[model samples]
Target: MHYVCLTTSDPFLSLRQVRIYREKATGQVYAIKKLKKLEMLLRGQVEHVKAERNLLAMVDNNCIDKLYCLFKDEEYLYLITEYLPGGDMMTLLIRKDTLTEDEASFYIGETVLAIKSIHKHNYIHRYIDVILII
Candidate 1:
C-alpha cells in the first residue's frame, strides 16, 4: 500500500472543514470526510465506517459519488471520495423554489435509480437526508 505523512498543520484539513484534500500526483481535487466527532467513532465506530466503505465500494454509477480510498490517523478516519462539481442537491434547492418539470423529473429519476441500486445491495443511505438537493 502507498502512504504519505500528513501533519495536523497540513493544508489538506482544517478544524472547521468537514472535507479537504488534493490528489497526490495530478493535483486533482477530492473531498475528505473526517469521522473524528461521530459518536460511533468515539465509542469505537469501526462497524459504521466499515459498513459505509463496503457499501460505497459496491456502488458503481456515475450519479453516485465514488469512494476512492480510506485512511486513518490515531484518532480519526478519513474517507476520500470524488468531488462533485455540481455540489449538493439541497444547496441547489434552497437557491430555487422549483425546477422545470423536465429538469425535476430527470433529477428525481436519477436519484431514485441510485437509491434503488443501493437498496438492492442491502444498504440504506442514511445520509440521503443531507443530499436531497436534487
Candidate 2:
C-alpha cells in the first residue's frame, strides 16, 4: 500500500486529520486514521483508543462504520477503513436546517440501532452522546 494523498488541511492536528492511500496491487482506496502514541498516552486515552479499535473490529453491522485493518509503528497507530466520500452527518444537519418527520425518524432509528450494537458489545462509545451521523 502507498499513501497517495492527505485529506486534511492541517497534518499537525494528528488524530483529527486523515490520509488517503491506495492498495498497490488492487488499486482500491482506503482512509487511514493516524493516532499519535505520545499524545494518547499523555491525554490518558490509551484504553479508550484500544477499546475503540477492539469494539470496531467486533462490530459486523451495516450501519456502523467498518474497520478494515489496524497497525502501528513506534510513534503512531493507523486504522484503515473503506473510503466514504460523503461528508459526515453533522455537515448534513448544518446544511439542511430541518428534516421532514420521516427523514428525522429514519436517522433517529439508524442512530439508535448503531448505539445498541455498540452497547451490545459491552462498550460505551465515549463520544456517542453527540451524534456525528457518519
Candidate 3:
C-alpha cells in the first residue's frame, strides 16, 4: 500500500501533472495524482475530485485511464493509475505539432471510440472533440 516517487519529473497536462511512483513491495510503476485535501476544500473542488474518482472507479473503457487504487493520508489523497509509458495523446500530438492525414484519421477514430464508450456508459463529455484535440 506504500509507494515512493520514482522520479522528480512530471508529465504535465493542461490542468494537472502526473508523477511516476513505484510500489515499495511490488516495484510496479504507476501514475500517481496527489491532491491536497485542504486545498480542494478551500477551492470548493472536493466534490469535483470525489466525482472524478468515482467516475474513474466505475467506468471500464480501453481509452479511459484505469484507476488501480486510492489512499489518503493526513494531508493528501493519492490516486494511482496505470502508467502510460509513451505519455498522453495530447503530449504526443503537441510534440509532433502536426500529423499526417492518415495519422489524424487514426487518432480521430480512437477519440471517437473513446467518446462513444463514455456515452455508452451514460457519461457525457461536453468538451471533447477530435477537431479540438491539441
TM-scores, each model vs. reference: 0.72, 0.80, 0.76
lDDT of 3 by residue, 28-94 (tens): 8887787777778787777777767776787676666668889889988888877656555676778
> lDDT per model, in order?
0.63, 0.72, 0.70
lDDT of 2 by residue, 1-134 (tens): 55566465333345545677777777788777788888998888889888878876898666655789988999899888666555555656779878899878888887788888988998878665223344
Tens-digit lDDT track of model 1 for 5-73 = 332222222421345455567667766666664555456656766777787778876666678888777
Evaluated at residue 33, the lDDT of candidate 3 is 80
CA RMSD of each candidate after superposition: 5.8, 3.3, 4.1
With a 3 Å backbone cut-off (N, CA, C), the pairs that clash in candidate 2 are none
Q: Rank the candidates by TM-score, best first.
A: 2, 3, 1
Give the CA lDDT, 0 to 100, for residue 28 in model 3.
89
RMSD versus native structure for model 1: 5.8
Winner of 1 and 3 under lDDT: 3
